[model samples]
Target: MSLKSTHFHSGLTTHLIRRGSLTMSYPRDPNPTKETFGVGARWDVPAEKVHEVWVGNEGCEYVIGE
Candidate 1:
């Protein structure tokens, strides 16, 4: 049997490294709706409220009140 290797985009790798200290609990969602707090949201905010305001978003790097 052959082992399959996984690959990540350079940008994604860079992001991971930059945010290495952060604990990424969420999965890599290709389509993170506002309901899930896609990104640029306050960490304390509930995922539901986040989506209510920010819909169709992506890349959650710098969180509020960190």
Candidate 2:
């Protein structure tokens, strides 16, 4: 399964696979932002430090909030 989130500004969708926890961007436009399109489209964070994955207009962030 996947965890999906939508960006407020771009309205693009970003997802993370529960298996690998890899961040991915699902663009809805022909020309998408760098964070939502391109060859290097996925990112992985250290699971220990990641409180959660946040998908925003700026892209996925490793939430470290307490």
TM-score of every candidate = 0.16, 0.22
User: Which residue pairs come into collision in candidate 2?
Assistant: none
For every model in order, what is the number of clashing pairs?
Answer: 2, 0
Q: Candidate 1 at 61: error in angstroms? A: 0.9
| Clashes (candidate 1) | 2
lDDT of 1 by residue, 1-66 (tens): 122222332222212111212232222456643233333333443332211221122223443321
Which stretches in model 2 have alpha-carbon errors above 4 Å? 9-20, 31-61, 64-66
RMSD of candidate 1 to the truth, in angstroms, is: 14.0
Q: Give residue 12's error in model 2 in angstroms.
A: 14
Candidate of highest lDDT: 2
